[model samples]
Target: MAGGGGALEIPERQKRGKIVRRKKKKRIGFRIDLTPLVDITFLLLTFFMFTTTMLKPQIMEMRIPPEMYAKVEVRASELLTLMLTPENKLYWYKGIADQNNPPQEISISKLRALAIEKNLEPTVKNRLITVLKISPEANYARVVEILDELNQAEIPITEAITKEVDEKGEPVKRQRKFTIAPLTEEDLKLLQGEGK
Candidate 1:
């Protein structure tokens, strides 16, 4: 009773003996019930999982060309064109347009792999010219994903559309033009598997 619980001793007179006393030992060892603690921990975990907000994805920054005055010529062998359609399908071409070589339809995730497969080194010494033709009807999220993939692959981007005030003081859209040829109907057929 002194410190929670303790031994008790009793003194009494017996019939045959003069006096008799008994000592009772205290129960020292005790067990702690951790069931409530475990339950509380799980409840807190569930609450935080349901209430807390997930972190936003980090955005990648790309360098844009200032002016289109200076023209740069990229070789046909060093070109890789990635075209995004309105249906979210991706089509890629290794080099310049030709009857023999046609654009192939590829998946979004395989872009990086295809770049590596075609040996499109994004270094300054052997720069691979990559042109991304994103259709106006394409989703902005798909374009962002493609840009992210390009950045993740450490490829240098060379194109940007900018609005500028012309010498006549009128705002006009300006874009740097590469020497790459435009996509033809044959290219579309190739992408659609008709040219296969």
Candidate 2:
């Protein structure tokens, strides 16, 4: 209630009128422009592509074993040969293929003892050679039993073997020599059929 000058300041809200009420209602479409986001993503991808260290670990080339091929050679002197027959009989022979008579026709217990003794040998401590003679009449059960007995003894043996068998099932004499069979008749027939 002073002199009425054109300055009317009743309340702070009344001073700001229609201009404040209808300021900018459309909100400028709230653009958030995904183009910049895309550009940033591409920039990050490019940065990673150019600056990242794609480390490739080095590898050594190894000579892999092939099927039907032996890995190592077994020496005669270092081996304790065991001959297993088709009748579940086992024979023990050592060094230069001598007459294997002492531990002949051995059962599981005898076989185990022989294997343990050979394994315990000072020279053949690591190398216990057991040659299993499998005849055509031999059952797989016997083979498994022999293997299980060997496993029970905890003595490792090799299948790398030299076979010697007589046609008459007689003992191989000192004059007798060991030779590997070249091929089976079935294999020959298959080859012949292929050729035809």
Candidate 3:
């Protein structure tokens, strides 16, 4: 607000026996409205809240083997089975499990090196079928790690139920194409060990 003069009056001065009107002084005051400021602040906050990106869970990419591809037979001699436990223990075996070639216990840290070695092996270079027999209680990260290693080695991923042999003492059914099989108690004892 502005004013022409203050409420208090000044004393008159005698000048040449004639009364003269004095010029009024300018006065100033200020008032601020905070409602608009508060409204704008809230609008900015709401805009950021709606426009900002929130964190999302990450999912691992997987390559699922085709159904027709699954129909192709895989030989036991060309198969490599890896058993993963919840304790991070890895048991791997090449070919059919027998007294001559038994499952060897290893650590997860050795998988990358093993993949590199297998990639160079003639038996596993191209005809190899790796079956991941993961336990139900195993951590999901363990499976992802194995899959990543396989990817690094340029190995194909698969999932299928396999058969060992027939009544004729011959491998009538095999790990049909390239696939990952769940580790059942029977499969664990057969592929890993009885103590597993």
Best by lDDT: 3
lDDT of each residue in 153-185, candidate 2, tens digit only: 552322212123357865433221222112335
lDDT of 1 by residue, 1-196 (tens): 2343333322222322342344555669989999999999999999999999898777566566776457677677777788777777888877775657667778879876665554434232234567787666778898888776665554322211123355887653422222223345555655666345
TM-score of each: 0.50, 0.41, 0.53
Select the stronger candidate by TM-score from 1 and 2.
1
Q: Quick one: ranking by TM-score, best first?
A: 3, 1, 2
The TM-score, computed over Cα atoms with residue i paired to residue i, of candidate 1 is: 0.50
Estimate candidate 3's alpha-carbon lDDT, on a 0 to 1 scale: 0.65
Q: Poorest 10 consecutive residues of model 1 by lDDT?
A: 155-164
Per-residue accuracy of model 3 over 73-152 as CA lDDT, tens digit each? 66777777888875667888888877777788877677767755654464544456778888888888878888777665
lDDT of 3 at 136: 87
Model number with the top TM-score: 3
Which of candidates 1 and 3 reaches a greater lDDT?
Answer: 3
- Candidate 1 Cα RMSD after full superposition onto the native fold (Å): 14.8
Residue 169 CA error for candidate 3 (Å)?
A: 43
Which parts of model 1 are misplaced by more than 4 Å?
A: 1-54, 68-70, 120-125, 155-196
Q: Which rank order by lDDT, best down to worst?
A: 3, 1, 2
